[model samples]
Target: MVEFTDWDIFRNLALAARWTVLLSIIAFIGGGVVAGILLLLRMTKNVLLVGLVRVYTEVFQGTPLLMQLFLAFFGLSLLGIDIGAWTAASLAMTLFTSAYLCEIWRGCIDSLPKGQWEASRTLGLNYFQTMRYVIVPQSVRVATAPTMGFSVQVVKNTALASIIGFVELTKAGTMLNNATFEPFKVFSLVALFYFAICYPLTRYSKYLERKLNVAG
Candidate 1:
């Protein structure tokens, strides 16, 4: 076995962190697009769409993210579509993130006073116009913190992607450990790297909560 140095471990893990970040970004964008549509569906008075979205939200939110990844991995392959680990991980995370984000945004939109909607309509605006021009702008302030905070969860959840053969940060660390036989130091660094990525976002989430409270 080739001897591994601290720099060697750092180099490999840092390289893998790129995928972790990239996967998170793709999932963020994909989930946001899907969530936007769901938010629109949620805003409507259509009982069927609202109920459909409710079930969609419940199914994804209720299930473990790990199962989602597994299905995307082995489950899809069983159907004769041989996808890569990256594709599988991305699909799983996108669906998982979308479900949570839909609810978060729906709550933000719901929290707005009915008068905002009434006033917009009173100004000759239609439903879409009211949401786009008036309601969405205000709800953005309410949504910003939770949206960002959930991003942290999105990043952390990528760790689970390793179970589906994604060579992300966690899997890279495990590989390094097997090579160097240094589980303690290897995994400790993994934890720190995750904290380094997530801690600031968490603090900022709390900061936004306070700011919004004061604004309210």
Candidate 2:
């Protein structure tokens, strides 16, 4: 067993945490792009497009993220597509994040009064123009808090990527625990690291919610 000092473990875990942050950012941004596309498609109110988006959302939302990671890593290999852990993890996380975000944003948009849509039409605004000028502006205020809250989930979910050998904070903790044989110390530090990353977002989310409620 390689003896790891307390400082050595802290430094290594801190280094690995960077990958966790990077992966979460990639997943959140990629997912946001995809969800934006889906939201637009659903807004079109085309039966076929709506159905397709609904199915896509249901499939990803209903399934476990761990299973999605496994499929992304292993299923593609079975199809003779060579994909690295990073690519597979990114792909799976993006899809999973997109599904949930789509639903969250859709709910926000739907919460608007039908009169708003009618008023937009009254002003001779087309669907896209109305959405761009009116609906989206209002929905953004409603969506901001939940979006930040969801981001915390995204950060924590990066830990799941470690299952597929992504060498993130959780994986580093596991590796260090093996070397140091100190589960209590190693995992406690791991939990602390996650808390440090997530707590601010959580608190900020609550603050936003309260502020928005008061504003509303």
List all candidate RMSDs to the true structure. 1.5, 1.1
Residue lDDT tens for model 1, 74-109 = 999999999999999999999999999999998888
The lDDT leader among the candidates is 2
Residue pairs in steric clash, candidate 2? none
- For model 1, the superposed segments whose C-alpha errors exceed 4 Å read 210-215
Mind giving the per-residue lDDT tens digits that candidate 2 earns over 36-118?
A: 99999987869999999999999999999999999999999999999999999999999999999999999999988899999
Q: What is the C-alpha lDDT of each candidate?
A: 0.92, 0.95
Counting clashing residue pairs in each candidate, in order, gives 0, 0
- lDDT, candidate 2, at 210: 92
